[model samples]
Target: MTTQQSASLGLQAETKRSSVNTAPEAPPYCGGDTPARRPEFFTTVSSLLKDADGVTVAVLRIDSPPVNSLGSQVRVALGRELDAALSDDKVKAIVLTGTGRFFSGGADVREFNTSKTKVEPLLRTLIARLEQSEKPVVAALNGTTLGGGLELALGCHDRVASPEAVLGLPEVKLGVLPGAGGTQRLPRIVGVAAALDIIVSGDSMSAEKALRYGLVSEIVQGDLVDGACRAAAGMAKGVVQYRRLSHKPLGADAASGQLFDDARKMAARKYRGGIAPMHCIACIEKALSCDLDEGLAFEAEKFQELVNGDQSKALRHVFFAERQAAKIEGVSREETPRIDKVGVVGAGTMGGGIAMSFANAGVPVVLLDSTDEALQRGLGIIRRNYEATLKKGRLTQAQLEQRLALITPSLDYRDLSGVDMVVEAAFEDMGVKKSIFTTLDAVCGPQAILATNTSRLDINEIAAVTKRPGRVLGTHFFSPANVMRLLEVVKGDATEAAVMAGIFQLAKRLGKIPVQVGVCDGFVGNRMISHYTREAYFLLEEGATPAQVDGALRRFGMAMGPLQMQDMAGLDISWAARKRQAATRPAHLRYSRVADRICESGRYGQKTGAGFYRYEPGSREPIPDPEIEALIRECAEEAGIRQRPISDEEIVQRAIYALVNEGARIVEDGMAQRASDIDVVYVHGYGFPAFRGGPMFYADTQGLDKVLATIRGFHAEHGELWEPAPLLVRLAEQGGRFSE
Candidate 1:
């Protein structure tokens, strides 16, 4: 039979089975004799296709390339196709799916805060139409469906997914809640507890887990659109019932006030100072108390409140900043050679973590050390780290073994000869790094890129030691290289553009956020943090206790206080850097001997059980040490400095503004590309709270004029130690922002 005849027969069968009308009134072009329009007649972003198998189901396929984000154009097109499908008598059912790996990436972030977001047929409006459709509608989840994409699926009468599909409502990460009936309909389909966890945590669930959660009716083993069409045809033939998520009643647990109370408490503890999580909980609570329309209105209201709020704007800035940091003005991926095999030269914590990062990405790595003992030890540490992850159920034994096999331990440099790139994670000493690079220059092929994972030292000086200076650059991965997302790609004066571009691509392959920077002391993160740490130490000399200083910045949204971070990182590392710089240190510049004195007493932070704060055995918590407090007093006395009470406000301003001032210098000196790159480094690498943006962003928000005024006041009272950056002065004078 023809498609329209088949659909008519199915609609007649559905009508015979149900007391109420199952089909909508036909439109002008609904009959079998009406010629079907081409797929392109609908919208360019999507195509309308009738199932060739004569199933009487029309498949609306979204074909936007890349992520298939539901932007204004796609929304308008999808709405048009959906309307046409509803009107057509040949289309007994409709199946919505995407062209490739993404069903949809949700609302286009590029369209956010723009007039396009409010253009005709918003995502919410399109979803409303989907939910109210008389003809059965099914979502064929082909791949990753997230945020508004998942919400759109929830609006369908039924959902069927391929085994590879991933689903989530992750708007909370951007500091906004899902506004398109996700908060209301998700709970009705899944229980209140599951919905809260899914929405509030902003985590994706596997298609298998989605089936278990009842989010999808079936996991399609074959083609997703075909299976979805079959499911939709079943509904059309009265073999399956239409299940609109909006009309579904909430589970009995939704009535429990304790359930919501517990969710709120969990969100408070997990998100800590975050605004979206609490607002998400509030919307879910509305689902329990209010009708679907009322709940959806509440969700939209809350979404609007957050999308325009300061926290959300800051978070969105960070999201864009991270992506922008990867783009170089003249560099393109095609110019860079692909990095296939990697080599890591060292076996310590940093080196081992670097090795694991490569292995995790399924790249073969040569982990070279001077001796078998150190190599074995590094390999042991790597295995232990993987074992810990396995115990957490995050890694399976087979996967752990597979990752471990990717890393080949070696005692000879010859093993790294064929590797595309080598990351030197050896000792921080310049001589040690220079010697390694010299040997690598001769031993490895000329095409291999040499990278130093140096935090503070000059990359230019290191590059000068190599014959092929063009091939040498710095890939300064943060401590615990496998865990930290930030990778500062420091380009030296003589480094080739292709080398820098290659490392940038390698950083993406390794799942690191790469920020290109120029050579400087401590590069971007550490250079700026040096001033922040200096201010913290200066605060201690001026009468702020460790607890008070740490508490102040912690309240300011720092992940941890500076002193605690130093303690956790081991004081010996920075103490060594100080000793190296002692000869060149300016006599006029004020130096704090507090850290040196603590190091003299054999206190090297958490590893040694003492530093600025004492740690009890088996605990990471910092306990104030009276001995260190006494040392601070003695240093102040020796320096002939008077101590006075310092408020938390002063502590926060001094510490944070110190970072801001130095960041301004870095930007002006061309060490960093832009002010936002500094923010990206600090937020991703230095634990400067993402919600506050970064130090530079924070300074802009506080007003550069006011910040410069505070710095000038400090500079007058504290000599050149508090010298305001020239860039800050000019910007402040011009009433401009660092971000601008």
Candidate 2:
């Protein structure tokens, strides 16, 4: 038990002064046992793991400098300390745990490959020393035990865990098998079928479930370290019993592992083309057929295959990219403002949904509209979304009522006072949004920040009308804002760093991931749309039907094809924008002309019952319209465009590269901070496959050189739309990444 957390009643020795010199201090991120430790960044690890009370039931607490990763220093210190304790005759039992909320976040990914050769030898010595100790060993799983941390815990004689603990060997999620004794020991303990499930899926399990599976010997009701000590004390005198996982005989024979065969069949179907899941299956097979050491050897081999692999490296890059993308220059994270109260202007789908996002995060929301009917409709939608959550067991009735109470619907601008921020989610028109901001500027206090939920309009233009333009920014939430994780925080020309910081903090308060962007029409999300749409049109003209192109892109993991997405979103939107684009075509962009012809007719989209695809009432199924096909042919004739057979490869390449090209342009224009930021937007807001990473990531992986080559070829054939970015061309030629 910790003074910083819950105190224990059983400290025989009186607590002494801080052991700054004698003991290793806990780092800031790891946390410590002091009043000052309440603020995580201030706590020193030295105070948390003081050697003053180093005793028989010593819990080797780990919360490594940050993210408690199992790197070289951690491994060395842990092994050395445990060895010293085991050698001391007075030490009867050792209980290992971690500080604060987490145990260890597995092995330190940064040191992985560099320490690969040394890993097996170190692990063998550590496991041997721990297992062969005259003193009993107990592992107190304080929080998440994943990868090698789980392996270390599994090696102990007894396992005791807290209720909040999550246990698993989740290396496979990063496309690698658990390298340290996972495949062998886990299957031996939990049976082949259960072990395979965790290993293959790379999914974590609750401590309660782990207890049911007999993974942990006991569960802690109160403080975790105390429970661990009690268990260790019991086992020290032979009161607690445990079976070594390596020595346990199977309940059923080896051939009885037909259960695993069936599981593998299902796993293969579930995890198609993925290597780690299959490798996990093979590890399970080896565990059933051979001894523990043999199984561990097999696991090690598979781990090597994964560790040296390109996929795992790509996954690791993405993992780090997500963490790094959150940093904002000139914005002090220490100055994060509290977003307890919010105002939502508009009683439409976006406003209602965004209001729900705030309420879900325990912030009160004031929803405003012109009439009670519109306000009631927005409230009704909020209620329905919460009701759906209730049905899914995600929200309790009491919790739902508490959240619903947070949202106060009103029709007057006077009610918007005393709010930290106001999100104007009104219609996507400049005049309406500007008028709302103008009204908000006069009504709200000087400190209140104004945010517009506009998708394509310029944030700078919206902020231009406000008295305090520095406080005006764009919080562009995707459709169904509550459900979508991505929030693009557009920093206007005059937006102050504090205001930008507040919007980012507000986004975090709403349980949304925020990526800061610069002001521009369509910003990052829709700008990329031009490329994909152009390719779709080119495909249609080249004798490929809309169905063919749609099928190809959809098969490649896009939720919908470019044409299909246009139809679903209503083509008239782009059609209206295209009219302006056409007037300034040579100045803005090169013309494609294919989409204009489709839109010039009364073909709006699903809303108009006709576009690229025909729709039946109340149905999502898209039927390719032959009428559109005939029109395409006629348009090709009128435009004197040559019609020819198109390949699926051409369709996929042309469409996707257009997106990459546009992204390069966005990056070069300083609209985006980094290429990875763009990827994050697409990954969350758009349906870019997680496995393939996002578009920018995908481009990086494809070898920028190769991408540039494709773009160059497209440029020669198709003109300015295919013109590669100067930066992109340079990076590609230098054999570097877009993010780099």
Candidate 3:
């Protein structure tokens, strides 16, 4: 403890003795002429405390639950307390602290797009009052202080934070920039470059790092409020002068044109079509050149624009959809079965990644394979993955070792006998999956939940081989499972509701977005993506070049074009799936043979250096190939179809609408719980741009009538291949959106 804190708080004797077991009594207040009095408390969303020391300093504790988001009520209460504290001559200093896990969660996201947010004493207005206060105001950051919360702290005269506190302005991720003076004040404290980086990326930094950057005045060790009280008392004694960030000069010259230019370029490449990141850079640049008030006005203007724009709307939809997807009706989390130990079958890429995910989440994993050699190879792959992440500075060596220690590799099924759950990520063949499940049923304990990681196989058929089919479900993790965020929890016809609920909880615990889907040839994501890729193939055969089609969708904000996506995923994989379906394919249904023909010619995408496009040695970059074009033309000729020029708009509509049409069918068939769940699957797993929402939301944005007209036009031209889904037709006729 510092000497000022010792004198102000008067706990030096108790702290120094070390042998005192009793709780230390409250010390005398640091005031002159007036005797100490008991604390007088006032309550709202926050609690206001007038200390006994002649009320020299007042402590306001924000008590909003969960994250202490600055809702309108909290803002109103805070405003009233600030007025009271400033008006009272006895209260010479004011200290602000949070009561729980968050110092503040920033602005209340739930209040966005609502009247409550615009109520009296807006976050901006409250911040202005905080900055303009005559008495010294100290912000005691106790925990996660973010967004408007950090902006609030920036406005205070002095800032102090706990060692474990994390600070950030993360509005960019929600497709907006900080509006409450964050863009202007942060640069003055952390410099323009750092402010730009932090705001653009929307990532939090540890309080220790904040101290190094001089963002915080002090790092309080224990009892954050008490330290803040002592600090406030010292300010009341005129030991520290009020520091206003707005009055401070920026760390860079306004004429340093290259800094902003570089930042803009980086944001453009990193965030692509994301508008908020670029806007954030502009805000920081404006802060460097303009006055504080002018910069704040500019920031608010941009923030309002984003809050009303389509990109922010889509991002917000995704945020809410993620929360809604977790709320499975009739399934309570309280009845969830415990999943302490997990077993991952197979030693291929998918199985290894799944094992790593469990280990990363601090869960013990038994990785079972058919042979010792295969088990060793899988473990080796997992170690290399961790080492690569370590090289990228995402993981420490100790963390890598700790996660690795949680995975136990074995060659025998008996080793998985004690596991509470077993995930079979074996080959995606029905016969193979059934055989694996049969063995698992025999070896695993009766309570073990059997999960299949099949991308497009029949979960019910696989479950039928097991004695306990009620406990069997499909937990489909996307490829490179540990890295992907989506978990398609496939609910089989006979799977228990409690089992699904348990898997839902487990997926969240493993840090994945679990979307419940019913059993089908290809669950929600792949089912919808099937039509998306099919349209891309049709477009190719209809005279659209790979570059033309891919470029249009990429510009539309898809992470990768369909052809390029195929190349990256290995064309042979889809070709195999197609061939498997060929036996059952309806004769009237038009099946494009372009991809299959490419596979037959020994062009299997990145794995073989050629598929829809060709690749150079050691590079995944796809180059347009004239040979593939010739092959596509040949297929068109063989199918007795005439090729015509296809426009980019047509290409995009065909691709995305195909997804919408299939998604509508999935929802109508009860294969997907809701339209939003399909959206969640696409956004998290399929690289669908969050800014556009998902296929279903995009359809709503485009209008169901327009989409229906387009689908009808395609159906007239291509017959069965472009048939409109029945649900789409109904919704269009009624002028209703998929969300309805």
Candidate 4:
């Protein structure tokens, strides 16, 4: 602790230690000839009993450094000062302020992890004293007051806030709520409707709005401590008016017949899997109709239930896990490379959208294509995207125009002169991609980065063509790039850290989540996706129809099943990639061998009016095609693979676990930095269900041992394709998560 802070705390103890461990009725601000007092206390809380002329006011200051958390020492010292101010006849109205910038910031977050150290009742007892004090208690909110901090201010008779202050109950965001009298006091003042809104949203309002909502009594601009002392003096002399929070009658619109019913339904829709918002609604309704004691009792009972629930635990885990993920393992703030100008090749759907993302964040972009017409079309796509944003009120016309003006589209390769980086979203063919890189190598500056948007290709080989191979990388973007959030940043064998750092910065600017991955055929995302589709195609080889598989996946919350998704994306695109891989597939590894056969039969998905299922031009309905089903049975019979009944559980498990097993392999091989990074890709790139957590988290939840056992069982029954990843086996044996 700082020397100044320790001295202030010592003064607090010297002034108020005599009235320790007690709560009592208080007196006015001062009496004649009263001695000025400073007390000895812990570094957490500070106090001084000063006489302004004839009136003495005990100022209880919470001084715990770094947010002044309402921890054990803070409660003890603060309770002591409240006791002295209430019992001493020499002391009149009390003033409560913080030593530094912040008032109490609620209970210490670290302390909440324990079961025994929570001292809410002790804090409440002191707050109850201030609420019932004969002498007025004024709160000086000088900073952001939240959770238990706001609850403490609620206990004061009058609240005076600094202009810079914002007060709210933001606890709901962290898997908990304001259990320390927030439910009772907030509804008491703001009423159930407004209080419930604030609680559910977890958004803090400004001091100005707080005043408008009657959350605080006054807004003081400068010298907040002096303003609080003046209020104490005014109250002591009967010069300024103040209202007690406890005596205020409840508002008429607290809860009518339709109010609570509407609340339950609304919460049901928005918070589908979430339980906190629903419990918050119930507590608010109880507060609306019940007495103060009854309301508090109900609030405590509900809090007890939610704090011990599984949903809270899950939400809390995700919260902390995300914080942990943001900190790069070996990279520090100083080592990160800055990105300025970016160049994007092809100027097609993905390239234009990707370029627009960088330009939107004020990064200069050079968009390259072969012809002026193609360049114009790409620029048109950028403008149309912004214009749509303007139409939707997501951006103002001027802002949209500014973003549009940031991009420079041209047909010449020389236009990429000073760009810090270039992402090539050219044709999927290796020959076409390699030719583009040769051109990029000749045109772009030596220091400039070159990245390809190839979904499934050898990044290392592509890097081999460049003079500075370390400057080349893979920046794979999903289809309709502007909409999707994930960017798989693939690092080649020779890729430099500065090149990666530049890409990471560019991804952040593009409003895309960049996850660093190692170079491989498909990197992390498409590699797993390829495995998922293989299992789906195999399911068709069995007795289960395509509709049955789609039904099962949709029931499990997938956006679309494999067959439907293929039709939407145009199956020929995947068929082309399949032919590339089919040339080298090992005889031992299981291949469904159904996709290309369908494409060869002139089924190019919805674009060509047929795929796994037939599609009518405008309508997406895939009517049961006897032709496809017949082909599946014929292929299975010819291959001597027996058809059997596959249960729904079997279907879901096979599809999910195939991807999970591949994800394990990627983690084991160091293709992905972390398992959570794999989860982020699936969550953003693929339509992975969030409620199940990510695939890795889901695998952990399902038990890694069990997942490994299942995969081993499949490997024994099937061939080499079902071979378990070493990481999965290790995690299973050690009983640790992939992230662990």
Report lDDT per candidate: 0.84, 0.75, 0.83, 0.75
lDDT of 4 by residue, 511-550 (tens): 7777888877789988898888888888888778888887
Clashes of each: 0, 7, 1, 18
Residue 421 in model 3: lDDT = 99
Question: Residue 535 in candidate 2 has what lDDT?
Answer: 77
Better of 1 and 4 by TM-score: 1
For this target, which candidate reaches the highest TM-score against the unseen true structure?
Answer: 3
Q: Is candidate 3 or candidate 4 better by TM-score?
A: 3
Which candidate tops lDDT? 1
Worst 10-residue lDDT window, candidate 1: 13-22
Residue 93, candidate 1: C-alpha displacement in angstroms: 1.5
Q: What value of lDDT does candidate 2 attain over all alpha carbons?
A: 0.75
**How many pairs of residues collide in model 1?**
0
| Model 4 C-alpha lDDT versus the unseen true structure | 0.75
Cα lDDT tens digits, model 2, 71-151, are 555566677667666766666777777776667667766665774437533654566567667777778888877777788
Native-to-model Cα distance after best TM-score fit, residue 29 in candidate 2, in Å = 10
How well does candidate 4 score on lDDT at residue 654?
A: 86
- Residue 717's lDDT within candidate 1 is 84
Q: Quick one: ranking by TM-score, best first?
A: 3, 1, 2, 4
